[model samples]
Target chain A: MATCCGGLKLDPAVREDARRRLLSVRGHVDAVLRMLENDRVYCVDVLKQVKAVDGALAKVGNLVLQSHLKQHVVTAHERGDEDQILGELMEILKYR
Target chain B: MATCCGGLKLDPAVREDARRRLLSVRGHVDAVLRMLENDRVYCVDVLKQVKAVDGALAKVGNLVLQSHLKQHVVTAHERGDEDQILGELMEILKYR
Candidate 1:
């Protein structure tokens, strides 16, 4: 969250939003853990909670990726840094 | 998944598994789209399904990151490619 968004010297607002959602997940996960509630950790309800965190993280990932594409990739492309652009594209392909 | 796992020239098995799970998401999201099921897309069941895919993708991401750490980063460090290793580390930090 920080790295992708951070790399761009992006607005702190965007970075903070990602941080907040991620922290929410961490806080919830910690609460769950503190309760020692592993009885049905893999059940639907628990899975839903897990999914909430996952979804949150994925959204953050998408934001970071979008930022990368817009700020880093496009800039590199515009500047004719073909090799770096290719490297970035190749890196993006791996996350497919 | 492919790119992250691919950069290291890992075993095809790992790559295939990531592809499979990703394809499953594609199939499912496509199926849902075909059925025009966005009316209740934000509901619990749908969110649960969304979470499943997110969870799977996160796991795949973890695998790719781990492979990169072991194969690329570790290997580079071993071979004294400190600069590349730092670049990789910095890249990984953004996905936090």
Candidate 2:
């Protein structure tokens, strides 16, 4: 059932890294949520959170994009179905 | 030469609404940025900002998405080049 050669179990270090980064991102989310809940609108504070969230999400997004490009994109390019694959890729890009 | 009948000039209220929403979003980003700059990683505050930013972005995204669906999507569906347009649509979706 494995899609790629890499096993389902990510390396411990990688897992930890992802966890830490995810927690960091979550922390930021929490802060902003608190502000909103209290109705204490701090524009600057919210802006900072957005930036941090963006940065964190970007990192994760790049990782996913890299994998997609390396695997699916490469395969599609070689299989003569680049158009179809490219279309799919474009759709996914829209999500960002 | 206009893409749609609606003029580019959003109604004053709409314009104000967009501006207020955008500014609110920016304000959140600024707050988070300040925290990062000072190395004061307040997880709760940051989290709140992330949520607010996401909400604001989602609202804006929905507006754009509606237009894309109404304009390009409708046109594509009628043109009998569904595959091509679908592909393109998929690709654009990929960005999100």
Q: Of the candidates shown, which would achieve the greatest lDDT relative to the real structure? A: 2
Candidate 1 lDDT over residue span B9-45, tens digit each: 5444544554465455445444423322222121122
A16-64: candidate 2 lDDT, tens digit per residue: 4434555565565555445433332322233334455656745644543
Clashing pairs in 1: A1-B96, A3-B94, A4-B94, A94-B1, A94-B3, A94-B4, A95-B1, A96-B1
Off by over 4 Å in 2: A1-20, A39-41, A94-96, B1-96
Error in Å for residue B68 of model 2? 29
Tell me the tens digit of each residue's lDDT in model 1 across A1-63.
112321334334444554455455445444433322222121122223334456565675565
Give residue A36's error in model 1 in angstroms.
39
TM-score of each: 0.41, 0.39
Angstrom error of the Cα, residue B9, model 2: value is: 30
